[model samples]
Target: MIYWSANSTNSNQQSLSGSNPKKKVHSGNANNELEWRDLEDYPLNLSQQEVMIEEGKAGSSWGKSEINSGYNSLLSRTLQVKGSKVNCFFDTEAPKILVVDDHAASRMTAAALLAMEGYEVIEADSGAAAVVLVTQKHPDLILLDVMMPGMDGFEVCHLLKQDEHTRLIPVIFITALNDRRSRIRGIEVGADDFLTKPFDRVELAARVKSLVRQKRLNEDLDHAEQVLFSIARAIESRDPNTGDHCERLVTLGQNFGEYLNLSRSQLRDLMWGGYLHDIGKVGIPDAVLLKNEQLTLEDWEMMQQHVLIGEKICQPLRSMRGVIPIIRHHHERWNGSGYPDGLKSNEIPFLAQVFQLIDIYDALTSERPYKRAFSPAEALSVMWEETQAGWRNPELMQRFTDFIHTYNLK
Candidate 1:
């Protein structure tokens, strides 16, 4: 979300300006009060009052002092993530806060405080409207109103908590109701926190900050769990005759995935995809998977079911739908002759291609009951020959080689 702002000096002693044009200024102070130049006379895109009102939602009082303090804190935090002297500006990567209230004055004030505190703020007038905005915007936090017609705050919170899609989002009730029953009801309906209607700006800011921090921590933990499960079934069930096959494949797949310059989301998928690439092996009869002799034609056919088996095993992870493509297609050949589906070239998912290379490499290099491990050189020679024979994507092969060299793979 890119936001353009007129040049301005903030109360926190931070200024954002270029030699190009007119400037507007905003600042936060020791008491967290915010002061911004009244640009009513200036060609401001939005009113100064508007900015203040938005920032107020985050608990900054929007007074010159509190605004100044909040801005100072925000600047320091931004600089820590980016760097100092890079020209003070708003942090674009910051999470958004949605201020939900039927009252325009309250909504505006809260929003202003949040903005001054360096959070992007969105406003919704009713509970129904808030629900729409929540689904569309996916705000980092929701500051909900307790009283609204048609769909009240409690109902909205209940709806949000019930949906598997939005249930994890933290919601804080912001209302004038100070009754004990109201507070209990809010918690019962899954409110993470609450703020009274007439809130102390400083306290509000602190609570928002704390909630945002916890949200980040939760996201990290979720990622860790996904990664662990993705590979656990593959690693734990296999015998020593395969000799840590899943472990070796995981390392190679991860390295190759990084080489592909995959995003964190993609990396997560691949991590699990690599770890569970052989999950289908679980369904293979022990007679076939552990056979010391060469695989009979019928036995080889049964081995192919592992991909389907793996896909079925991981079906519960529909949230990780992206992973299914890679898992099912990892054995697909570039020439469209491999696996459960004969997808070729770009038709094959990228992660699957990555795993294909690593899988073959691991198979060649690892000792099996039927044969001793091949030398790295011998393995590479075989891979190269297969590439020349149109068994794998030549371009992907080159990428695999670069990945190997960059990661110093054996």
Candidate 2:
């Protein structure tokens, strides 16, 4: 939530009729004059009025989906603004909000207010309806009404919070319930905040704006933690034998990447990728991945599929786009004998190359099903031997060795 110090003046205009409507008329030359009119201002016949009455609520400003989207956007944007890093939640994108309410009048009112203050808004009508819409829409904030017939706001909030899939969403109760008891009830039921009926237009805008900033920051932090935990879990699940390996790997990889003069972005991705380098193993059968004996040709093929599987799993992270290539091709040898894609030398992704060297070192120094852990010196000797066979870049190997020497990576 990047805070823009813009004054958001909530407009009192009737709900906008539809998505920006435009009309065109022939520019009158010297003889004629150009004409223009708002499509909404046009009077309607009886049949047209009926159609308008039916569709007007949905088509007008602040439909159910639009309002819910506005609220959610506000929450996400606020969290982002308060988060540790700038542009943490959004990737050069505008904040969007979602509002959920049954009444079209309320929907339009909320949308008009939010729009006047510079928010992109979407709306949903009911709790049950919002569940499906929210999953697909993923608005930043949710403005939920407390009293709906089928599933009330509390039920909706509980459902959202309970779902591991959408639990991180921040919900603010927007209702006419101004009583202290009602507000407390709203809070008790999992609402982050409550906005009463007849909310001050200016105050409402300011509060929404402020909340959006805070929500964005929180979401940014949440997203970072989520990524870190995901990577850690992926590795732990893959190599259950190496307890705490992911932690050591992250610490060591961060230092090693820093030694290699990696950019901040590169360092971040390398740290994550390094910690979860063996995540692909999760896809391998337990027998193959945890084999106590040397792998046969078939077992080796199965073992190698982990890299591709890991790549697919990590593909959703647009931030780690660079990491995916490295993760996928890390096993390739310098001589092009690697499984999956047999790219050689400079063709291998650099992050994967770095992880390749560290990963091998870690594996050698850690206990496995088949053998006891090797001494640091023995691991170093093995790496040296592998280098001679053109399995790794000598310079990178040396750099890794220097890292071990400098940091005493144990």
Top lDDT prediction, candidate number: 1
lDDT of 1 by residue, 1-410 (tens): 11123222333432323331343334343332333333223321222233322232223333334433423312111111112111133234656677777776667556645655656566776787778778877877888888877788999999999997787778999766557777899999999998986656677777888787777667666675566465555544656777666667767766777767788887777777766777677678889887878899999999998889878767765555777887789888888888888887889987778777888888898887777899777887899999998788898888777776667645
Which residue runs does candidate 2 get wrong by more than 4 Å? Answer: 1-235
- Give per-model CA RMSD: 18.8, 17.0
lDDT of each: 0.67, 0.65
- Scored by TM-score, the top model is 2
* Candidate 1 Cα misplacement greater than 4 A, ranges: 1-236
Error of 2 at 177 (Å): 37
| Per-residue lDDT value at 12 in model 2 | 12
